[model samples]
Target: MSAESLERRTRNYLNNNVPQIQDHGGHFEVEDVDEETGEVTVAIGGACSGCGIAPMTMNAIKHRLPDEVSDISKVTVRQANGPRAAVMPNKTDEMEAMEEYQDYNPPF
Candidate 1:
């Protein structure tokens, strides 16, 4: 029930749950965990962050996170401006980069 363990387990859980959440364009990153109660705080990112279905996305993550990680007693999704802001897209770096690359049109 430590911060490090909480962080690790949260990331692991997210990794496994990614495929399921992907349909909704849901994604998350483990920011930090509470050392005392092992509360895992996640940052909801990607298209799920800023979508009409974001509320559903939040619920899905809330339900799945705890069941996926045993030590996690509480899960907090950080919504900064456009993060978990209920109307913001905060995709992971790789995902965003790939998307950018995909959309890129080279000037030949």
Candidate 2:
């Protein structure tokens, strides 16, 4: 598939299967697609900066993205705010509530 098509497909997959990303004010950006190797790089940003579930989100992208998006053999996720953001000093009630669903695995 063309790079544009691949990116579009990836975005659609994220929207449909990983709605939490958008629901939480986060977003995924298709940074690059290696047509020759079937590899994709994505960046997760916005509220995801200090999200407690950011690691899970990245893991899902790495393991599940390929299964949903055609022509994608591997996925690399980049955190926009760097690794430090993964650990925040405080957690709000909403964030704590989200922890209850940490094991959530979206239906394919």
Candidate 3:
């Protein structure tokens, strides 16, 4: 397929899959897609940044992008972490939440 065709397919796939991430309380926005390299660079915003589910998004967004466009070979995700951003509720809250999630009393 042509480069233009590849770009369109990749863009469409990205746009389609991003909304589904809402189930995980996260979202992805595709910033730019390189047809030649099959590299997609996207920004993770909203509930995704500091959420407990952020890490999983790495695979969901980065790994699957290439599936959309056959020519896409790589995906680069860039995150924007800011003090006052909505993604960050607060440092103390974030740390506490992570710790709590880590501490588990497993069933024998």
By TM-score, who's the top model here? 2
Which regions of candidate 2 fall more than 4 Å away from where they truly are? 82-108
TM-score of every prediction relative to native: 0.60, 0.75, 0.58
Q: Each prediction's Cα lDDT score?
A: 0.61, 0.78, 0.61
* Residue-level lDDT tens digits of model 1 in 6-87: 7787777677656544565656677777777867777765655566434444556666687777877777775434524465
Cand. 2 TM to true fold:
0.75
Pick by TM-score: 1 or 3, better one = 1
Q: Say which prediction, candidate 1 or candidate 2, comes out ahead on lDDT.
A: 2
Tell me which of candidates 2 and 3 scores higher on lDDT. Answer: 2
Can you write out model 2's per-residue Cα lDDT over 35-87, one digit (the tens) per residue? Answer: 87889999988778777667667877899988877799999998786544555
Weakest ten-residue segment in model 1 by summed lDDT: 99-108
Off by over 4 Å in 3: 1-7, 22-26, 82-108
**Which one is best on lDDT?**
2
| lDDT computed for candidate 2 | 0.78
Write the candidate numbers in order of decreasing TM-score: 2, 1, 3
Count of clashes, each model: 5, 0, 2
